[model samples]
Target: MLGIGIVLSIFGLGFFCWLLFTLAVYALPFLAGLTAGLAALQSGAGVIGGLVVGFFAGGATLALGQMAFATTRKPVIRIIIGLLYAVPATVAGYQVSFALAGIGMSSGGWQTAFAVIGAVLSGCTAFSRMTLLVPPPDGQGTGGAYSLADERLHDQRH
Candidate 1:
């Protein structure tokens, strides 16, 4: 029973971490809102006030980040924005990696190495998640289409 419990706990932790990595972009806003709401509540704000503040704070942050990314055309500016999104994820990943490696803060080099690896992995994951995939051109129909003739006919009707 003890062994089973330990196994289950480990599995749960792993699953949670997987979700975090996979959904970091979406998760970030909720985390920001929760943090802000708790802070507000602790500061003597009423429950309703806290909820409103949290909702706006989270939504604004997400919307602003997206808008900045969408509106910017310069490569350097876009890269900077991407880095902004990635840095927090990298920090979180480093913390998780450090904890999992069982390396004390005093362990210096090993800890640094693991943290770097974690940061790289998490940064890439975050960047990939944030990127929008463009749809294929209409001219390139799915293989299910019988031929270009069918595609041309369908296109003409529309």
Candidate 2:
């Protein structure tokens, strides 16, 4: 039992750290794009403004995804909401970039590429943070399990 506990604990912690790392990685570029977009907005870059807004909006929505995860115990439902919010954000980001570059929305692959990247970054980062913060079902997996142990132990007794 002790070994199992330790193993589970270690895996949980590792998973949490990985999540944090992923958040940071995804956040950096998204933030950079957001900042650039805002700057563009200031300079009358309407298209850029759109890009910035789309990126930040997606990021904000990603945070919402986190909230959903924290409040809901159902993984499938959480994922659906997260994806629904995030996927549109990504698509919007791509469209904004094309508009910013003065390219038509029908510009084909380039716009799509931007959208895909934005969505991937936002979704991965947000999901990482959300999953870490939320306790898993079955009471077996969650980030910060070590810190939650005292409470979990108490709950176990009840």
Candidate 3:
């Protein structure tokens, strides 16, 4: 029974860490949504209204960020947008990593180091994922007639 408990705890921790990593990019949108939800509630909106407002606010925040990142041609502008999303994720990562490290290790220095590593990885992951909002640079994956024609023309020349 004790061994089973230990195994279950390990699995739970792994699942939690996976969830945290997957959701890190949404931290900024989540904060926005939470704030909007609380504001709506404070203004006497019912629970359902608060939830609706929060959901919309979060969705809009994410969509707008992705749109701005995807549509902009300037590298500097894209960096700025990526940073906006990554900053929150990095901070959250630091906190989460520290807590996770505390579950096993007793050394504060090691915990801090792991936390820093986690922050960097999480921020980088969020930054890279920004590209997912846009189509591939080659345009072939978009399934457009232009892409097919371009391919055939290139094939004939070669």
Candidate 4:
């Protein structure tokens, strides 16, 4: 039983880490949702009402960010949008890493160092994920049949 418990603990930790990484990109939306939820709860909304409000708030935050990222053409504007997503992820990563590290490490210095590293990696991951919605560089074939037709013509020409 003891051995089984150890195995299960390790498995749980691994799963937790994976979940952290997978949801890193949603940090901003999560932040928004959490804030809205708390506000609603404090403002006399019932539990179910707060939850519904929070869900919509988070969804709108993500949708707006993606749309802004996809529609903006300027590199500077895109970088700003990317930073908005990354900054929150980095903060969350640091807090999580510190908490996780406290489970195994004792030294304060080491824990902070580890947390900072995790924060940087999380920020980079968030930025990369947001970049997926970037607009085409040349503004051509951004959507519709044009981009498809352009690709076919390029293939035939070469």
Q: Which is the leading candidate under TM-score? A: 3
For candidate 1, the C-alpha RMSD (Å) to the true structure equals 5.9
Give the count of colliding residue pairs in each prediction: 0, 0, 0, 0
Q: Which of the two, 2 or 3, has more lDDT?
A: 3
My TM-score estimates for the predictions, one after another, are: 0.62, 0.35, 0.81, 0.80
What CA root-mean-square deviation does each model show from the true structure? 5.9, 15.2, 4.0, 4.4
Residue pairs in candidate 4 whose N, alpha carbon or C atoms collide under 3 angstroms: none
lDDT for each residue of candidate 1 in 21-60, tens digit (9 for 90 to 100): 7765654666788889989999999899899989988898
Model 2 misplaced regions, further than 4 Å:
1-66, 97-115, 136-139, 142-158
**Model 3 Cα lDDT, one tens digit per residue, 89-133:** 999989998999888899999999999998888888788788778
Per-model C-alpha lDDT, please? Answer: 0.73, 0.58, 0.89, 0.88
By TM-score, is 3 or 4 better?
3
In angstroms, how far off is 97's CA in candidate 4?
0.8
Scored by lDDT, the top model is 3
What TM-score, to 2 decimals, does candidate 3 have? Answer: 0.81
lDDT of 4 by residue, 1-158 (tens): 99999899889878866777778889999889989988999999989989998999999999999999989878899899999999999998888888887887899999999899888888888889999887556634546468788889999999
User: What order do candidates take by TM-score, descending?
Assistant: 3, 4, 1, 2
Score candidate 4 by TM-score against the native. Answer: 0.80
Return the candidate ranking by lDDT, descending: 3, 4, 1, 2
Q: Quote the lDDT for 110 in model 2.
A: 65
lDDT of 4 at 151: 86
Kindly indicate the candidate among 1 and 4 with the higher lDDT: 4
